[model samples]
Each structure stands twice: as C-alpha cells, then as structure tokens.
Target: MNVTFRCPPELEQVLPRPVPAKVGLPDWLRRMPATAHDEVLGVELMTVKKCAPFLDAMGYGFLMPLACDLQIDKGRLSWDWDLPATPGETYSRSPVALHAAAQVRGSPFEKGAAPMLKFNAFWTIELPAGWSLLCTHPVNRTDLPFRSLTGMVDSDRYTDNFINFVAEWIDPSFSGILPRGTPVAQCIPVRRESFDYRFEVMTQDETDAFRDTRDSMDGTAGVYRRDMRVRK
Candidate 1:
C-alpha cells in the first residue's frame, strides 16, 4: 500500500514532513519497557497491556505532523502559521472566531467542540486504489489541547485534491506558540470491502477452552504477545 504525500512546492521548506507513528512516538512512551510493565503503572496509570493497545490503535497508520508552530490568540481571534508562499501570500487562513455551544447542536466531546472553529488544510494526500483514509485525533493523546473531528475520505477514487486537519481549538485560554512538529492528526488507510455481521455463541468445548486459557494466563503480562497474537 503506497501512500504518497502531494506536498505543494511552497510547503516543502516550511511543512514538517508526515512520518510513521513509530518515528514520532511520545517521549513518555519511549521509556516504557514492554517486559517490565508492572513498574510503569504508577506514572502511566495503565498496565503495559492497556497503554500498548491504545498506541497500537493509533500507531497503525502514519501521522500528519504540524507543518509549523501555530501561535493562536483566542481573545483576539487571531493566529499565525508562518508559511511563506509566492512572495506576499501566507499558507493558513485568517484566525477564526470560536462559537458558543448553544449556537450549535448535538453533544460534543472535544474541548473546543462547542464553537464552530476551523482552518485550512496544508497538504493533499494521494492514496492507492481501493483504499480510504480515516482521519482522527492522534490516538491515546488526551494531553493535546484541541480535539480533531473524525472524518473519512475515499482516497483511492478521489485523488483530485488533498485533505486537512480541521479541528476545534479546544484550549480557549491557551495562547502561545504550539511548537513545530506537533502532531495534528492521524491518518489510517483502510481497504474497502463488503461483509455481513453475524452473532454466534461459542460451543461447549470452545467455551471451556477459552475459560481455561484465560484463567491460566490471567496473571501473565505478555499473554497476547506470547500466546494469542499472530506474528506479523
């Protein structure tokens, strides 16, 4: 599966290149040892198993990093993304005003969801045939100030344009430089296929085996890695 980034010429020098999740793993996670998960529970608040899975979910695809540090002034409804394009033009749109939740509908989860705040996208991604991209907030990162709304694009069939990380500026009080290379979104490429859903109960023998294995492996830390998970 080839996923090409159609970087506009102007952004080549300014935009931080999108990279694989492994390359940009949060510093805290880097110190974690998969073998000695018990010791890491205090600071991380999660067993290695729980934390690993969350990263696994988000780390499956490439991450779109912030092209440049964005300095936003919520009080003034102003911002700056220094991407010099063509002589006089800049890359980003004007700082947008945040909206109140009462002005919109539905129960929103993100911190900035109440306000209809949006910005322009910087790049266009070209996906391979029969593939679509799922754009979502970087996984397992509740620390980020703003929350990105999830969306899907059929990249395979629609290659004429690119996509953006249109998100809510969750932190209203946060007014400063959001350093360059900060991840704004995660893009997961999914193969398109049709299938039906079905529900079935396990047989008596299957149920017994499941219970026995679970009981035997309950205290083991790497059961999924050593016993159940298929080696990629």
Candidate 2:
C-alpha cells in the first residue's frame, strides 16, 4: 500500500531538532565512545510507499513510524539505526531494532466491543528542527477485508498497543487463531498471492474529525466495503 504524508504549515513548527553529540566520558569512565541525538531535523517533507504483502512478511501493517525515522541531511536522506557494537564489529544497523523503538504510546484495549492485542514494533522519520505539520492522507482505509473471528483494532487511534496489535494480526506466527509455529513468511497467504488492496492517507486533523463523528451516538451506523471469494 502506498501511504503519503502532508504536513500543514502551523503544525510543522513543532518538530524536534537533531544535533550531533558525544557519547563517552573520560578515561576513568572506561566506556566505549558513541554518538547520540535526541531528534532529527532538516526535513522539508517526506513521502513513502510500502507493499502490503512485503509489510505482512515483515510483520507489520503500517510504515508511518519507519517513515518518521528517516532523516534528510543536505540532500540525502539517511536512517539512523541506533545499534550496539559487537566484540569485533564497530557498528551495526538493524532495521528491527529501529522498528522496535517507533511504537506509539498508549494501551490498545478499550472498554468496549473491540478487543486489543499488543506486539513489539516501531519506526520513525526525522524532519527539520521546529518543523511541524498537520499531516493528512489522500486515501485512508479504516476497514480492510480479511477472514477471522478476531475483531479489528481501531486504526483511528495511533496508540502503541494499537499499532502493535495491527502488526501481530498481519503476522502469521503471532496470529492468536493460527496454528503454532507457522513461519512468518507464510502469514498472509492471500496477500502473497495476487490480491487487490488499496491504501490512502488521512491527515491528523482529518483523522480527528472522523473519530469525532464515529464517537457520536448517531454515528453508530458505520460503513464498510467487502469483497469476498468462496470456493466450492
């Protein structure tokens, strides 16, 4: 699915600033030297696209966090993989490690019909300092077609646990209803095959508006699109 980000001028002013800093103390400290930064900056804008099947294979459903982790410096965009050095190796870049840190913050389990699940996954993209924007998407798919007893998570809320639940659901191994020991590669068989799926983006403001409408008592009449195939 191809997802894009559009930031409004007002919101773009709140982004964090990234700066290079030292990571080691004096000789007495006896610690290895490294580099650390609190945030990423110098990002004017960003655009990202992820294949649905590939993302399912990678055990994730969303790339917002991953896209956020990307940093643009000068003219090149770089992803900072905060990795630890091995005994012999000087450095390493693990996408998994970077992913683990990009999770949202909050519980997924609410007090209603929609149950919640959690998984460990995260991604981020760095923009220029003091950059904030009202992000919106041209297309947004709140409802995706899949067969399972498990209820879908609320995508409107960008909580950590919520994001994790989405990841594990698409992951074959972690799927609560699936047989144990299923290889991650085989999780989304339908997605693996030639299946048609679409993705779109919703700006932060737009998402808020949708949620507001959905939250209203009169809004219980929800809408969904379904395309099912049955074998005889």
Candidate 3:
C-alpha cells in the first residue's frame, strides 16, 4: 500500500499522474453503458450486467501516460518527441525508437508483424517487499495507435532503472500528434505467491454455493459489493 513513484526533476514537472482506469474513459463511453444500446446480437454492451466487465476492466488499474508529445511523420517514420517539462532540452535520439519487424526475434510476434517502437520512460516505481508490477497496455484500449507488449517486473528488488513501453505500431498511416499525457501503460501490483499445477473439480458444496451465488446475483446486482469483494 506504500508504493511510491519516483521521477527525475524534469520528468516530475510533466509526468501525468498515474490514475484509475475510470478516469481515462471519454465522456461518451462513460455514459454509453446507461444511455445506449443494451444488447448486440443477444450479447450486451450498454446496460446488461455483463457490461460491468468492460467497466470493471476500464476501472481496475492505474494508467501511466506518455510524458511528452510525440509527433510522427509516416512518410519517413520519423518523429519529434518533445516535452515542455524541460524546455531547451535536446532530444539527441527520438523518443520513439522504431525497430523493424524483421530485426526482432525470440518472441511470439511473427516476422513482419509490424514495425515496433518503444516509448522511453522517465518514471520508476518502488513497491514494498513480496510484490511485483505488471506493466502492459491499458486494458480495453485497443483504439490506440500502438499495442504495447506485456512485461512483469520485480520492482521491489530491481531498483536501478525505469521501465519503458515497448509497442508495435499498429496503424502505419497514422501521423500527427500523440499528445502528451497519453496513457501508454497500465501497472498493477501483484503479490508474490506460490502456485501448483494440479487440477481439481468443484465439490458438491462449491457447486451448490456457485449456483446460489449466481442466482442471487442474477436476481440482483452488487453481489460482490455486498458480500464478496474486499475493499483496498
């Protein structure tokens, strides 16, 4: 609970505060769940309880935003990554480092998948013991121009450096401003725990309890709010 974010003086001035995913929602989307379509081909998006999943995903973790403005010109795949935090600071290297898809190996991404670009990071986090940080693209944020790769860091132990965002540029023709404070990654603290691979089925008591819980939740919402979820 005592996790802390540390930044260089230059970065501290411009770094967007890490915020709950709910704050990232555009006004239109935040209202869609109540004001629009209720079902799509029998599946729901607007008002059904299932839509809560989307809301939940969009409200669960903290989003880390880009510290500066990144302007890209598709014609040459070049950029001017600039920040107001440190005026007159020279960007010797483009903040967006474009790596040819063909040059990368040892990952699930296929050859020629897309040109990969990495966002240089200026923030580092210090979490307490027995914890790790899961860094990846913001959940349900596929609308962005890039797809950031997932990474897990033992922030409690690795304190020497910052973590950057590694993403595959998804839209090749996109140009112009990727404005400052754009959420680039989501970080969630995960406690280190033991795991076993053996499988098992639910007992009769569990099956009955599951049905009871499902029926209760179906009849009324807030099952988790009322009886299950523990507040942080």
* lDDT of all predictions: 0.68, 0.26, 0.71
Q: Model 1 residue 173 lDDT?
A: 83
Which has the better lDDT: candidate 1, or candidate 3?
A: 3
**Poorly placed runs, candidate 1 (over 4 Å):** 31-46, 49-51, 73-82, 87-114, 230-232
Estimated TM-score for each candidate: 0.78, 0.18, 0.77
Pairing residues by index, what is the TM-score of model 2?
0.18
Give the local distance difference test score of model 1: 0.68
Tell me the lDDT of model 1 at 147. 77
Q: How do the residues 70-177 of candidate 1 rate in per-residue lDDT, one tens digit apiece?
A: 666773444466545477644444323344555446555434345555534566788888899998988877677777778899988777565765676667788777
Local accuracy of candidate 3 as per-residue lDDT tens digits, 21-81: 6777645464544534445565433353235556666666678877667777873444454
**Cand. 1 TM to true fold:** 0.78
- Residue 8 of model 3, lDDT score: 64
Instruction: Tell me each candidate's RMSD, in Å, in order.
Output: 4.4, 24.3, 3.9
